[model samples]
Target: MSRELNNTLYQSKSEHNDQELAEHQETNKRLQRLGQEVLKLEAKAVNSLAERIGDNFSRACRHILSCTGRVIVTGMGKSGHIGSKIAATLASTGTPAFFVHPGEASHGDLGMITGADVVLALSNSGETHELNAILPRLRRLGVPLISLTGNPDSTLAREATVHIDIQVEKEACPLGLAPTSSTTASLAMGDALAIALLDARGFTAEDFARSHPGGRLGRRLLLHIEDVMQTGDKVPQVTPGTLLREALLEISHKGLGMTAVVDSTQQVLGIFTDGDLRRALDQGIDVHTTEIATVMTQAPQTAPPHLLAAEAAERMERHRINALLITAEDGRLIGALNMHDLLQAGVV
Candidate 1:
């Protein structure tokens, strides 16, 4: 092609690329601004709740605390989803609670509610037909009702034993048609109630662990060192007079990277680990000729079998060690564990 034609084509391509890049940058800026606006609005809605946590909030908490039965949460549509999460939080945080779909409540699920139970109802407009329909029955059953709604004048709020105003100036949705900020406000309010009740009941981490035994937190809090440590034949050990080469074999066979040097009575005299081996080798000592006691770490840190595995993990991290010897009150080596065991058990 001619030089003139080539120059024209390159200029056109360059202009097109520059235009596309500018448009892409503008689009990114618009998207980010929109996202930031939503966050600010939701944050404002949640913050507004701080002032509303007054007598009514306390009354609602008292009702739940006094109830003998579970807290029954009910709502419609998006409100229902938030209610389910609130119920779960309440249940996991020491309050017995469960969600009953408002729609289903009219269809025989209302039986789930009783005079001893407390009802927590959620609605942005406070006029959800399905949710409101169950309110009369809840009253007839003499159940205390705690309503969270954006409209204080609505029927549900007026009938509630304690009404928490979850009003938001506007929704996060640009169209102002969705349940954006309102749902967020409701969720924050629910979380506040759950945590307050948790504190009032003196709920602890151990209690939380009992409710969530299958989760990582439960494992860390509830698992004992005795549950994770290698016991009896699995524990690697050698006498204090054993050669370093033999101790190394025991470490290899047990796969814990260390072995306990114990007396005839199974009392731990010292521990010889891979780090000790490295130092002994640096001194040009023969593994076959050196006694394990000569190179072992004396008075190594030991954990009781009843210690929480999570505590053992923390101890190991603090001391920069990989293995631990489990000893009884009498200083007898009963078991052993390494960092890998903690990791496998999800205690780390």
Candidate 2:
């Protein structure tokens, strides 16, 4: 009887493991199928924009470009979240833009919009009550309205100076209640407008970098050699006639892994790095007595102070080097930097 009881317990545990495995597989299958459906619907919505981006998109870009003041973006609900992101993108991409809540705009926030500013309103359903409530006020202020909506005949659409129809075939939601494809379409439309204006204004990466000074791209684009390079006493430098042993001491003192071989006028003539020391040792050169000019690499690559830190990184990468000397246009060594400096500056 005891043996039978143990056998029963063993069978129960085995069955439970099998059941858990089957449940996990089923859950994974359901998640994958749902993900695929959502992606397909969203892609279809965005692709549909190809056909709709005609004269109206051009007009929106042209009007926004011609506006002397900032672009004021406003929306309600989920549209507001997307509107905020769109406004940020526009602002970063050379179009000055900011988002205001439609509900707030109905209050004293209406004062934020002026005649010089262009209003870009987002509403999947063009008749959002909060947005419609402020249309007359916007009109009174003489602000041009650009509407992004699914219902072109709705109040907001009809009231807009330029109506952009962002209608999607259907939402990815199984119940057709929550916004999915419509919001994706609106966000993509906003990106399209921002990029159009970016190209129209000839916005360069330098301009974008200036606006994003705290970001990694900004560090790379805006940081110059003069900003991070070591100068004055921090530079490990030696005259051409300096002994190799003494130059090694300078390299050790500066901790830059290298030293510049310069002339009397502080003009860089060559460079000696840790690697050069290794080769000198292998070739049986006497470090105590050898002149650095005899062993150092002549006519070493140099950079100007104004060269971007990212460009300096590229130079280091291309040459398989780890250090660079910052020079003036006339070949005077002004500063020095290494791979560690670029890393510390977040340029690499």
Candidate 3:
């Protein structure tokens, strides 16, 4: 929308004029119709997927599930890029797989293949030059083959042990030269394959986190405070009877902006933060002679050493605090972590 029209519609600060109101209503109607058209198209595409799940697709799944070695995916053009991502999804979801570009397979990359591996060939037309060149070698090696193509009777399909058809009547593109609907179909089919294997393997979040340790989901599900917390002598701790001034030295030395007041056995008694210092001065309490027991805040927020770093980060942010004392189940301070630790661990 143009800025002038947008401001007239939204920034008017009152109901629009009669003529402007009619124009706005007409524009909204037009946008609604466009949304309806897109929904209809997407519904047709998704339904095509459900309808295409037949015995052939089942057979292909069975073949892949029974395979002892990796699934070697290959394709030409748009199918190739989709094939690469599909292969990656399969690998991450517990199905061993990798994509080999058909063009590269003919240019000395064929050595990566073995007789034990299954070749998953993808092409809209089922006829690609580079793929044809490798078919002879694949046949010689006596490897099982799977074809994903629009044409069911092409040479590649004819030689395959299992053929999965991805036929579509038209391209989503207006020009018809660009691959759009066909690519969408191919990518959806790839997702179907990955999801099928993902369910079959009973893959859990932990399994996925093991594969993607750098991702946000991995950090949320796999990272624990014990893995990143400051433990032992580095944790700032002071006895409850310690003078307030002495606790300040511990906080400054530890640089966590807080000090834990504990008993002789190290069980938590209370905590004092930099904020507590400001309040003490306001109340005219002498830091030098006053015991931390008299001024320390009881029931300070603490986290278990086993809690996820992300969960701890959320708790701290919600409470508007920077640091948390990691305690054992018995309330003994085991470790400490602050906002900076989470940032360094890439879990923030």
How many residue pairs clash in all the candidates, one count each?
A: 0, 0, 0
Residue 46 of model 1: what lDDT?
98
Name model 1 segments beyond 4 Å from true.
Answer: none
lDDT of 1 by residue, 226-338 (tens): 99999989999999999988898899999999999899998999998899889999999998898988899999999999999999999999999999999999999999999
Instruction: State the local distance difference test value for candidate 1.
Output: 0.95
Best by lDDT: 1
Off by over 4 Å in 2: none
TM-score for predicted model 3 compared with the true structure? 0.82
* Deviation in Å, model 3, residue 235 alpha carbon: 1.5
Q: Write the per-residue lDDT of candidate 3 for residues 171-254, one digit (tens) a residue.
A: 665566777677778888888988988898789988999899889888878999999999988999999889999999999999
Which should have the higher TM-score, number 2 or number 3? 2
Pairwise TM-score winner, candidates 1 and 2: 1
Better of 2 and 3 by lDDT: 2
Q: Relative to the true structure, how large is the alpha-carbon lDDT of every model? A: 0.95, 0.94, 0.88
Total backbone clashes of candidate 2, pairs 3 or more residues apart or in separate chains: 0
